[model samples]
Target: MPRAALPPVLGCDFSSSPSRRKPVVVAWGQLDAEAGTVALQGFHSFASLAQWQEFLQQQPAWVGGFDLPFALPRELVSQLGWPSDWQACMQHYASMARSEIRTLFKAFCDARPAGGKFAHRATDGPAGSSPSMKWVNPPVAWMLHAGLPRLQDVGADFPGLLRRESARVALEAYPGMLARELIGRRSYKSDDRQRQTPERAQARAELLDALQQGQHRLGLRLLADTAQLQTMAADASGDHLDAAICMLQAGWALAQHAAGHPLYGLPPGIDPLEGWIVTAPLSRP
Candidate 1:
């Protein structure tokens, strides 16, 4: 079968409490698979989850890499007596109050040993991410709580979690997964103005330079104007840089699909209840 034409791609830096001060940042762009290039069109910030959901519903066709966990750990879900199926689990999860989620998850952790308090999904180690059940610190659990429901409501297609629909494909993406590949453990950005130092700015510059120079092994080049590059590098929050990195992952996934890896490089045995992160280095059992 002839491959479908590449659609627009998006990278989203999600926020559970999306406000004017800390909105959800979305990077919009297109991928030129033939040239192995990702041209960043622009960035948009949504001050509320409603606005973000509206945008997703409005877009007819696109592929997106969102910096949010698409599913929880199967162990956690099973322990909580939630559905083991991805879609059903998400639906059940979305219906609960944040307080209830916290209470249940906390109870689970309270029963576990100190060193291994959290139950992790398979993708956590390779992606170097916090467990999806973590409610504090980064609050990735809240991000998942906020983001995945919007995708489900919009009827977006997420491979492994749902059947592949040609209109909109949503993939789980972690900028850290790609960033660590290029710059290992170097702090890049900070939300606190006091912590946003020259060192972090330099790291962002180095990261952008590497992407422009095609230093990443993904074989994709980021096409951004000088002004855009400056803006991305100047952001102390690192949201823009993360979105851009996700855009690259989206490009890579698109290229993978074009090259006939229909699951966009996801492993064949990925756990159905815990979706894998795109472009993460897979570890063998």
Candidate 2:
């Protein structure tokens, strides 16, 4: 039988408190690994979470990458006696206000040593993601708090946690991991004007060049029209480029699924309470 057609893929650069000044940016694309290319379709920016929610509901079936933690640290869950089940745990988490989350997570950190302050999911280290419990300096905890409920409400299925008949499939994505692969942990874009130096801009330019030429391990080049490429490059926030990275990760997962890996390129036996990051190498311990 011929291979089934792949769904349109997306990558999201989400904000916990989205506003006109800082919106959630989504990159839509198509990745053809055999052809060694991923074409950028366009972008959709949502000024409010409700706007993004509406987009998720109205769109056709898709496999997308979301730049947020899908689940919390298993150790944190066990320590706090939150529900061990993924859905139940999220329910417990979402019920709290951001202030309450800060207090509790801070308390958890206070009791531990400085270097080992945060409880971590195994994938955090391998994927080089901030702990899902972090409430500030990226506030990934707030991201999960804000984003997961929307995914859950959309009736989307996450591979490790759910396997229902659904039009949308959601995977955890970390653009920094892929960026590190391309640029080796170099600073790229910045939200702060003072921090957005020429050096960071140079890094972003180089990353785009490498991605366009298929210079990375995934062996997939990015192909965007000149205007779109300029849009991604000009935005010093890096939101556009990050979304593209997420799309590439989703594309990689889609290829793995097509190749018969059940977890859609996620590690086998990933903790349901701590979902895996897409496209992270299995070789990392």
Candidate 3:
């Protein structure tokens, strides 16, 4: 089938509290899987969570990779006596305020050993994602709290979690997975303008070059015009490029689905209450 006939794909770098300065950035594209290419078309920045929700509601059918945890650690959930079932668990989690969550999670971490601070979902180990329970730094726990409820309310088909009748699909993604895979541990972005040094800009440029050259494990080329490429390179925040990384990861999973793996290459028997990160290997590849 022509790529146009397929649903549009997206990679979203979500923000728990978005403002005009730091909006939720999304990279929109179409994947030509057989040809092993992803055409990055444009970017969308939602200044508010409500604006992001509106976009999700309007998308009739699209496969998206979102940089947020879809679920929490099963260990954490069980220990807290939260609902074990995925949907029920989400509902229970969604009911809590951020302060309550931080307090409870802080208590949980405080009880553990010095090195072992937060609880980790299965996917975190393999994907190298920050623990979803971390309320500070990246504040991914807040991200999960903010993003997951919207996804649930939108009624998209969340593979391995909730398979709805709708064609809209969402998968957990970590842009760093691909970045680390291709570029090792080099830091490519920084939120602080002072930290966005020439070294980081060079690193971002190298990452874009690698992506365009299809030098990664997924064997997918990123198609972008000159201006778009420059824009991704120029953004010191790296949100734009992160969104594209997510889009490529989503495309890889979609390719897997097209080739007949129902889980979209996700391992069988993964913990449903702690969702898998798409394209993250169970071990180093």
Counting clashing residue pairs in each candidate, in order, gives: 0, 0, 0
TM-score of each: 0.96, 0.97, 0.97
1-285: candidate 1 lDDT, tens digit per residue: 975678899999999999998899999999999888999999999999999999989999888999999999989998999998888899899999999999999999999999999999998988898899999989999999989988888888888779855588999999987787788899998889999999999999999988887788788999999888988999989999999999899889988988899788788889988989998868721
Better of 2 and 3 by lDDT: 3
lDDT for each residue of candidate 3 in 36-100, tens digit (9 for 90 to 100): 99999999999999999899899888899999989988889998999999999999888998889
* CA error at residue 165 for candidate 1, angstroms: 2.8
Best by lDDT: 3
Q: Model 2 Cα displacement at 108 (Å)?
A: 0.9
Give residue 211's error in model 2 in angstroms.
0.7
Superposition error at 225 for model 3 (Å): 0.3
User: How far does residue 148 in candidate 1 sit from its true spot (Å)?
Assistant: 0.4
- Give candidate 2 misplaced runs (Cα > 4 Å): 283-285
In terms of lDDT, model 2 sits at 0.89
**TM-score, prediction 3:** 0.97
- The order of the candidates by TM-score, greatest first, is 3, 2, 1
Instruction: Record all residue pairs in model 1 with backbone atoms less than 3 Å apart, i.e. clashing.
Output: none
